[model samples]
Target: MKQNILTGVLLAVIALLVALPWFAPYFYIFVFTEILILGLFAVSFNLIFGFTGMLSFGHAAYFGMGAYTTAMLLLHLDWPLLYTLVAAMALSGLLALVIGFFCVRLSEVYFAMLTLAFGMMVFTIAHSWRDVTNGSDGIAGFRISEFGLGLDLVMGNPAVYYHVTLAIVVIAALVLYVISRSSFGLILKAIRQNPERVAFCGLNVRSYRLASFVIAGIFAGLAGALMAPFLRVASPELMHWSLSAEPVLMSILGGTGYFMGPFVGAALFVLLETWITSYTGAWMLFLGIVLALMVMFFRKGVLGTFLDWWMNKND
Candidate 1:
């Protein structure tokens, strides 16, 4: 019954998303696009942090790498947008593989700190390398030519881009959902709960962790790739440690235990920011208060807490 209800709710949400561009204003259409992209980013982070129990403080490294990859390809190579996205994922996956190889060797806070260190290293490189990355100003003014597959759609139109973003994000979300349901995902959860026991069962815990990290990075890169086109710039700010914290907050806000929790958290965060910023410059203060309240009272996250209440009431 719970699963049925959840499925119905998900379908309803997807329907609304599909119809949103038609009804929503142009500004809101772009806002929703941001929400989808950031939601995907948060979900990717959750794969590593929530499922694998790896508290990485530097997940934005992959996101920034992907954004840079897409921006550079579009500017220099003038590759199709689809091709750039592929390249972004590949490069991000490679970076994750290298970082995770060492980070996974450690556990607990050590792993987290190591990841943070590497993340800073990436940030520093992006900030100082003016020739290639264009320094702190980052990459900008890249033209969006073809979306590939011989589709001659107008890439400049906001509505058209929203639809494209919607399609790509939906497909990516579905893929991540499948991964979460697979045996590999189950093993990840087991490792999260008890790594020693997983090791005892002859499964390589570190290997699984590295795999999760790489997969998360690939998705993060995809999210970043989408972002660069929407924002029309790839800035070093995207790779900052502060940006990395966004997904951690989102996962905690949405409920780390559930597959869709991070996405829910991202939506809440974006919506709140949109509403709050209209009234005051102290939006961050208000956001911090809300997060504190959530942590104190709704530790399971808004969606998770609501689900529990619904199930209990039904019971």
Candidate 2:
């Protein structure tokens, strides 16, 4: 069928991307790693913002939790990469569950504000807890050891790490896609469209929202886990409100309604940043102008607008 062909083509494209390091320049591998990690983070944020109709300004709380968990595990325990990542997910998920229980009680702007408050609290702890977290200096000099698949991995090789990141990100993205297509995802969508109607229909809308929140948190944590090792540090900046905005911007730029939109948006964002920064120091100013234009004209986002045009043309 036509759908199967399209799916195959998409898979082929992704396969090529995963193997890009083999063909592209060394610097590009680093850029691609950033794109993959940030793309996953954006997708996780979209689960709540796009599907559940919840705007959480504090989502970085989970991201930071994951990074800190992984960093501490690697720094103190010297745990293997797999174990560290698992711990990161567990810690982040627990935090999301606790925060989401309270957050889901409110709606719209109140929910965003409450999440933002919780996020700042997490950032404050990371910044002030000098004894444990190393305070503002962050946890650095962390290294990745054996990958635990019976293959000895050279921890210092950027190319190898890039491949590992690609594998993890692809798996996480696939899992998210499956979840988004499931019955639970449908219920969440319904709740988003009309929470009162969903509640009247015997569904616990709050619980569903919490579940989605927790799921998103776990994935965000995974992104954080990747980032910790990639960046060679885990600090309070991971928990900062500005860090939380990355996913929001990606989702808005890519189109929250489409599954691949955030990923596409992330790729564009990183590439643009890299190119623009090389040309001028005023990259932020340029980004601000571009984002403003996006908000004013391309409200549906790049992917959303493109999809709309394609669908309409076919019709």
Weakest ten-residue segment in model 1 by summed lDDT = 306-315
| lDDT score of residue 191 within candidate 2 | 85
lDDT per residue (tens digit) for residues 1-315 in model 1? 877988999999999998998899999999999999999999999998889999999999999999999999999989999999999999999999999999999999999999999999999999999999999899998989989989998888988888899899899999998998999999999999999999999999999999999999999999999999999999999999999999999999999988889989999999989999999999999988977898779879987898888889847
Name the top TM-score candidate: 1
Worst 10 residues of 2 by lDDT: 1-10
- Global lDDT scores for all candidate models: 0.93, 0.90
**Model 1 bad stretches (over 4 Å):** none
Candidate 2 to truth, TM:
0.97
- For all predicted structures, in order, the TM-scores are 0.98, 0.97
For candidate 2, lDDT tens digit of each residue in 53-118?
Answer: 999999899988999999998988888887899999999999999999999999999999999999
TM-score of candidate 1 versus the correct structure, residues matched by position? 0.98
The whole-model C-alpha lDDT of candidate 1 against the native structure comes to: 0.93
Pairs in clash, predicted candidate 2: none
